[model samples]
Target: MLLLEKGIGGKSLLDIVKVVHLTKRIIPLFWGAFLSIFILFLPGRVWAIQNSYKVGIEDVLSITVWGEPELDKTVVVAQDGTINYPLLGNIAVAGYTVKEIDELITRLLAADYLVNPQVDVMVKEYRSQKVLVLGEVLHPGLYILTGPTSLLEIISRAGGVSDKVGNQVSILRSPVEERKIKDNEHASTSVEEKEAKSILIDLEELLKGRDLAKNIYLEPGDIVFLAGKKDTNISEQQVYISGRVQKPGAYEYQKGLTALNACIMAGGFDK
Candidate 1:
């Protein structure tokens, strides 16, 4: 009835009783408009995070040229971080993203060959960025990180950490980290270094926080290590049972195993 007074018309008193309405129907439309404006003009914009990789030495990339198969090629990044293309002969590709590489190739081709060439550069082999697991890992070795990979992921790939090892582990960021620590005094030190010493990526922290960001992005020749914890002295503990036991076996005496439990395991002196 109050809404009818505000122009929400009802047929009669009986109709008004039946049609209990609120303010103008435009209220929903107004709210919808407000929501739209809020979303569109939001101060902070959320962006889709992208995983990027820097091309490195010895990495192999496959270059595809649409409608120009002759220009298509597979080239290994040289020790000096360069590649030999058809016309671009010995172009440096390291430190450039795949998109940048494509643009570079397109520019090179348009300058001489095609009017507007389509260049596609893909990492056929990601030998450039490999995760190296060493020290106390069950299967410590070099693991190729083809795509998105993390500390726990790499550890799982390496057959999980050795039971003897503790949660303490470290990840060394690749060539950059190496160069950063070197005596290249002329090199400009970036913010990464200021945080590198004490804030080097810790595996324990990653395991706790479940945050992949805590785990450093692995690169070629990056070394990861699992530190060993205190050893359990199994040599000193021993258990022996003597009697008419079925399938009798010697069980190692552990922290809390009792004589009765050991006997029960050995068929309990069968009558």
Candidate 2:
């Protein structure tokens, strides 16, 4: 009986070893098949991720290298605007477009580790970009922007414009520096050259879909102000209708009023 039990135990141990070996061989094949499907569907869904978006801090990224699945990783851009790549340490990826980062990674890998590596970059999450929506929006606050968002899309995200919102909307933007200067060329100016700019959009035309050009893309830090029913602040605007007019006097200046209308408002032109 002891001999039979020992023989049976040895056979079971051999079977267990065979099963573990089979699992080891099948795991890589399963992983490869899964990755093949992911790569196949990636191009089809490429339109969902705008290629025009620039990378930013805290944005999650999925980077993959074909034929080398071990290099694929999902990483978040650090506050220093960089990502830690395998064997490359920290590489600055933020403030750069994904295409640029792809080219960079491809070049680095080819130079250091691989030969003619095919790389793909995709943003898994856009946690960096944001826009502030205020004034007359049902949910007036900050909104996290994910893709190519138009003015109308942002309005909708804020629960659409409130009933009190007027036909005009104002977008306040901050100017960014266009060029980089070397240390020797840099000037010691107390004030930055960036200036505040305001864009006026005709919301009435935009919402009606009559003029799509009125729809504008929102940038980071852009403030959307919806004009309400309150009167616009006018700083002493008086139009004088004096020449050849009966009872000529000063009138309140209003937009779209022609010269004839102005004269009529000042008691009409003398006959």
Q: Please list the Cα RMSD from the true structure of every candidate, rounded to 1 decimal place.
A: 26.2, 26.6
Residue-level lDDT tens digits of model 2 in 1-271: 0000001111110000010000111122332343344335544344754576777768899999999888999999875567888977777776567877788889888987999999999988887766656555566556676666678777767666655556778776534322221221112112133454677888777765688897788875555766553453323444444434465555665533333344457665344
lDDT, candidate 1, at 121: 87
What residue runs in model 2 are displaced by over 4 Å at the alpha carbon?
1-48, 175-193, 231-271
Q: Write the per-residue lDDT of candidate 1 for residues 1-271, one digit (tens) a residue.
A: 1010100001000000112112111112332343344335534332211125566666789999999999889999875556888876877776566766787788878987899898888877766555556444455555776555556566666656544555566553322322221121212222132111112445455555566576554544444655544463434434443333454445554433332344456674344
- Clashes by residue pair, model 1: none
lDDT at 50 for candidate 2? Answer: 51
Top candidate, metric TM-score: 2
Candidate closest to the true structure, highest lDDT: 2
TM-score of structure candidate 2: 0.60
Structure candidate 2, residue pairs in collision: none
Error of 2 at 75 (Å): 1.6
| Per-candidate local distance difference test | 0.51, 0.58
